[model samples]
Target: MQTEKIVNHIVSWLNNYATNAKVNGFVVGISGGIDSAVTSTLCAKTGLDVLCVEMPIHQAESHVSRGQEHIQFLKETYPNVRATIANLTPVFEAFKKEVLMEGKQDIVDMVLANTRARLRMTTLYYYAGLEKLLVAGTGNKVEDFGVGFYTKYGDGGVDLSPIADLMKSEVYALGEYLNVAKSIMKAAPSDGLFGDTRSDEDQIGASYPELEWAMMMNDAGKQETDFEGRNQEVFKIFKRFNNANKHKMNPIPICEIPNKFK
Candidate 1:
């Protein structure tokens, strides 16, 4: 689809949902990453208030700072949008100490990471509820309804998603249409919980472009897409992240009862 049509479709679709939900607007986080950048822009353009927040942790040097620039752009471009920076280091530090003392942190890094995500989500919802707005999720098509790339109750939860069907590459294209700042459009994406820490690609072996391709190609409809043999790597990520982040996405495991309890 043409960029204009696609953008319009997204705007119209989201507005439909927002109107149905009776939200004041959308509350989004600007993480100095392309996904959130695109999401925030789209939400603001939809003629809804976009409450953009920058919740960075101790690792604020890399992408967090850049996200602020995008927020400024959003504020100027969309009068309905505004931003705030809420440092989450204090809470993360306290929680980190507790986790360290538990001695089970190694087995639960997933939990800790999701805790950060949930913290951001909590803040988003706090303002969203107060302002009667929907929380605009930042996950892209590559990660949409994905097996696992988000925290269950954390960043994954939202009242609406504007970029759920656009691939990372497509998001970049849209960024150009929206004239997103060069810095933000190209900045690396991170959860910001790890200072100069490894990103999703570094933590795993795959890159976002390839991963997005992998995800898009995986669909049976794209049978002719020819992803060119990244299946193993993609599956590996699928397996590893799914295994590690399972707790964040699934219900509590319960032993199967084969008619044992009457």
Candidate 2:
């Protein structure tokens, strides 16, 4: 891809979209990940008000540091960029106390992890509403479309997605072009939802590159029978996630009423 042209295109698109919507700018949740770093930078390039929010809930130290470093970098580099820390740890703890935790340990943990994402989503939207800003999404092609590696109505809830078309590798290229903080660009991709150091690869059982390849193969009408060994394993993993999380990818189903009944 022509990196400069792509960057300009996204920046222009963001500017036009905000202007058309009559919003001041965008609010992005910075998670110390590659996607958010690249996304927030793009928003800043539009020369509009960009608010980078850090909403950590039992977040790992590395994630917090990287998020702070990126936020600082944005503030120093872009006059339109500003940042705030919501620190949702206490809110999360309070939520846990009020909810029922009676389920299989793994299932309960999964629900709570998703809750963390939802809480962050709420925080970003709160700021967006208060400031007349759109909630900018930080999802990429693989996570948003291929594997559905996001929480529905959580991180998946957004007013605009600037980098959803770009692959993970392409996002990294944009990060390098945008001069994103080195610490963030080098850190392994993570959701930071679990409050631990496990990388996205650990949770997905396949790296972005592997998932990208699998997505391409699936798009090209390839099947599991066509692959052998590790390739087959990766394909299966991709298929499992893609099939399981189709709900996130598809629009919410609405029951249609028969015209005669009306």
- Output the number of the TM-score-best candidate: 2
User: What would the TM-scores of all predictions be?
Assistant: 0.83, 0.99
lDDT of 2: 0.96
* Candidate 1, residue 10: lDDT: 87
> Once superposed on the true structure, which residue ranges of model 2 sit more than 4 Å away at CA?
none
Write the residue-wise lDDT of candidate 2 on 1-262 in tens digits: 8999999999999999999999999999999999999999999999999999999999999999999999999999999999999989999999999989998999999999999999999999999999999999999999999999999999999999999999999999999999998888889999998999999999999999999999999999999999999999999999999999999999999999999999
Q: Roughly what TM-score does model 1 have, to 2 decimal places?
A: 0.83
* Candidate 1: residue 259 lDDT (0-100): 84
Q: After best superposition, candidate 2 residue 159: deviation in angstroms? A: 0.3
> How far does residue 247 in candidate 2 sit from its true spot (Å)?
0.6
The CA lDDT at 5 in model 2 is 99
Question: Using alpha carbons, what is the TM-score of model 2?
Answer: 0.99
What lDDT would each prediction earn against the true structure?
0.76, 0.96
Model 1: lowest-lDDT 10 consecutive positions: 219-228
User: Model 1, 57-147: lDDT tens per residue?
Assistant: 6656758668878888888888999888888889888887875545476546656777888888998898888889899898876565444
